[model samples]
Target: MSAEVRELVRTYLPEFPIQYCKSLVTDTTQFMSIDYGHVIELGDVHYMVYKNEAERRFGLEDPKYWVKRCHELETGKRKILKLEFFETFPVQVGKFRVECYRSPDKESRILDIVRGDSRFMQGITIKDAAGRNVRVLEIVNGRRLDLTVDRIDVEHDVYFREHLPGLLRRYLEAVRAIGMLHRHGERHGDIRRDHLYVEHGTGNLCWIDFDYTFHSYEHPFGLDLFGLGNILVFLVGKANITVQSLEGMGLAERLEGRLSSDDLSIVIPNRIVNLRKIYPYVPEALNRVLMHFSNSAEVFYTTTDELLADLEPCVEALESEYGRKPE
Candidate 1:
């Protein structure tokens, strides 16, 4: 068990503690039937499983234990249980190729790195009975960032005027937290708008889903940077303003500027990275920050610090344009 788990993480998760992997010994395969009143132990901790909406509606034939909500009997607290899953995907950006994987071990390591940081979702890692790692995370009380952004009812100009700056600041906080991951020699691995949770009470932007893993000959944090760029576009446009997203709204003549192949993402070209052409009033500096990830971008962000550096001035510019003092 020790040898097998070590080989798995050492290959898939870089800089991970192999001995830690060796200690965890059981896969949560039996957890599928965990219904209401079921009591299970993970490491030294025990949890009483309750019926989530999916289980209540569908009657417990669920296979995915990656997102199970549980009530900790010992601590008498609610937490989420994530079982180990093995997934690998390939992503291409220009000439660079990246292989992304879902590694629970890596996420466990990151849980240690960001244990107390409220800017991120909280979680604890422990080994299950069959040498598998399980992540018991806080039940984040928040809405998905994408959904929260989607619920905003405003035109592009109004959103830009009233909302974008604040959203950008919060996103900068998240990007900086990703920098913390980099500082610890890890990446967010999966960075989607949905992975972000906007806390209900505090309005703090919390990051979830740190189980993504990839190592490349190109820049290590390159894909993370790419994901950051995608989120930036989402914030700037108030949603993911793709050509398809904007299709019914106008013809080519309705846009303020012409679209070129360069204005799109090199990997996913349909996403219009250059927001200035459509919004017209989007700050040029902010648009250039977005373009850093576009097909036309001569160079990409080498480090999170670089990305943060580029955006700081854009924050100031945005505040000035909105006639508000920069925070």
Candidate 2:
């Protein structure tokens, strides 16, 4: 990552201990990496420093200070991330009372023992100064889902355009993982394409960024749904209105001067037409899911289970259509 990228990440996470340091031989911008010195450990869990501008925006310094901030927040008070403070650190930052932090090691343990989906991340852990630990996940290799490849393309050796069906299947598997989180009453706060890692050889989708997951609340599942739609749109080569575009359009013009959440939802639709128009090959069942996801007006699927149920039939139908079998 470059200084600009580090700044961008810092904008979201102000306390991220790593700073934009030296350039690498690789053709990428300089960005922060773990300082290692700031790490702290507690009860078998490791934490890494994390901070963002939202801490000030929401006046949530006290909330962010707690070892387990999610558990401490009252569900009735916060509806997932309707407010700004509960934004970037999407999933559980610490073992908060309201939420449970999934260890990167746990996922790694499964990957190490399991023979399938070998593309998942291996064992890695990092601790931070605030004792706010998180599973260090690899950033997505290509373009961020919300931006067109041309706009925010990341040059990487791994590309999977040639295997469309394979790509879709991998995506479905990754959704199943998200479904697991949903089953546990948690919603992945960020589900964009850039958050998903593609195993170099297998071309499988690996879900990353469990930082801002919403847990056990009557919160709208819209964020996850919207993110899923964004991923699908990107997989097929389309752009959704991203933060970059929002910045470019001038927030006032984009929002028509309505800065409220109600107005913000309209921004993406205004810029990106729809994913369906971009990929005709997208199955009808999947399309229905996308439709529900893209809907800004209604709360369609209350949980990932509901969405997965709707998708099950589609997966089966596709498998049967070409005598495909799960590998």
Candidate 3:
């Protein structure tokens, strides 16, 4: 987290101020996952490789494709940089060899570019091939609270009755995070379990990985709202629930047994059902929130606001039911 420590950690990467020589250019056809990263050596000097022929052969040039590149930095530990981008003009231009270009200054400029992008995520250290300072962000580690629906044995209502409040809190946080991005006209294109990192200690939900974070896009809020709904269902152990299953399962019996069904079509694929099948006893007010999101009619909230609204009552219900605040 410190600057000295960060620089020391980056030494394994190609040292700063290095640029591609003209001769380095090749067909680049075989390089599938093309990258413009620098190769660092122990001498504290940097070497620029335009393309990895092997990677090209395997079709890595595409950006959305994720592949890990590991090399021993000066610290002897392998620093892993996940090449996550598509093959395109930017990559091609970046691959263009540049020897005469000022590597140090270029690195600085790239750093500036990175800093200017609000979509960029924090925590990891970035540097140019020459290993010049890019930008270092504050550490924000995501929490892991994975509760897959298939993993729970309790009936839906029982689980919802018991855990809905806490789950709602996390859901609200996710909605708010989405709203924050929406306010800036950005969208977390991919909002999955892996992308969301919750800070259990702080009751905070942090978004991670900006490789697919989108800017300059409208309607991102709607997409994000759908994603939040999916996530909320996931938390409540209904991510995998099906309409047929809900149909066959009696809502009265389900509520008696503590189960609630999710009917949000956006959250899943083609389904309409009530929460009762999963958790029959869920508070009517809370159930309405779930129903609205499930139906995509909760208009007052951007996905984030809806998420919190749905969750707050549940949190209060949880506290009153358990005699303690649910985490």
Candidate 4:
């Protein structure tokens, strides 16, 4: 994949330097995902964001977050720089305004918990020239879970039967990794599908971007639990099938008429929560677990332990029905 990406880069920028080409091996994510552009001077080295075909084709550094793809010139090492981005997002989760904070200090502790664990990104915080802390993480080269699901060629039914069962079982390792964090009194407040990557070398499903956290909360790990639920939905369905997407599937009117706002994801309103209604073949156990997030639920999951307790059996059943678990 790295070779293919570099080959595409060469086709785009024939005059691109060889050194720059080497840097792209680690920094292949579309430039739209970051606050890219210009050479940044941190304390010890300069951080330059790599250019790619998307950047050349669309010509957009359509930057969002303060993350940047960079190389340590002094070391010629690939690194991801999370440069001083902090946000306190106040979300109303029933009675609580779950304040999500993106802090480097908070993330450092999460990193500590997963230290020497291949299932998470490893990084250290360093104070820059003016004394602001900048997170410097080694660029993990691999496939994002979202991209991996997208690339699967089979239909959802085929994917669910042949592929998803194995992934669902493997996904528990990641689920439990978060459980370990929660047990240690920490939460990965930002648990988007893209934040997870399967590493090229280890094939470990590694979690990245832990800086977003809510310090004090009425509901501990509310965001993290919800985020995990969303990922589960994606995996269970083989891809995220929103209420809007159902129209294209020719099931829109039939399913939409039956759905209420309660049936939608509590966190993301348009995302379908009761997936089994659309894809009836979804295991009853898994569907029931997913339905917990809908507005129809009486009890909500507050811990990964509880989530895993219910989830483990459903996956075990899937493995039983689908064949042996992946070795």
- Models 1 onward score TM values of 0.83, 0.46, 0.55, 0.81
Model 3 misplaced stretches (Cα beyond 4 Å): 1-65, 69-72, 75-80, 87-121, 124-158, 198-204, 213-220, 244-264, 271-273, 295-300, 325-327
Which prediction has the highest lDDT against the true structure?
1
After TM-score superposition, the amount by which residue 156's alpha carbon in candidate 2 deviates from its true location, in angstroms, is: 21
Q: Which sequence of candidate numbers ranks them by TM-score, best first?
A: 1, 4, 3, 2
Q: After superposition, how far is residue 317 of candidate 1 from its true place, in Å?
A: 1.3
Relative to the true structure, candidate 4 reaches a TM of: 0.81
| 145-228: candidate 4 lDDT, tens digit per residue | 878888889888888888887787768899999988888988888898888887776556889888888744556787788889
In order, what is each prediction's RMSD in angstroms? Answer: 9.9, 14.4, 11.5, 7.4
In angstroms, how far off is 65's CA in candidate 2?
17
lDDT accuracy of residue 220 in candidate 2? 54
Please, what is the whole-model Cα lDDT of each candidate in the order they appear? 0.76, 0.42, 0.45, 0.73
Model 2 scores worst on lDDT over the 10 consecutive residues at: 75-84
Candidate 3 lDDT, tens digit per residue, 19-118?
A: 3212221222223433444342323422233332222212354432223333334334433333323321211111122111112232233333445332
Model 2 / residue 165 / CA error / Å: 2.1
lDDT tens digits, residue span 1-327, model 1: 245445444554435444433223245666555555444567656654554423211134544555577666556678888877787889887788899888988999998999999888888887777777878889789988887887888887887887778788888899999998998899998888877889998767999888888988568888888888888888888866677666576745576367788898876878888888887787788889999988999988988899999998998788777865321
Displacement of residue 270 (Cα, Å) in model 1 is 0.9
Q: Candidate 2: list runs displaced more than 4 Å.
A: 1-162, 214-217, 237-267, 271-285, 295-299, 315-327
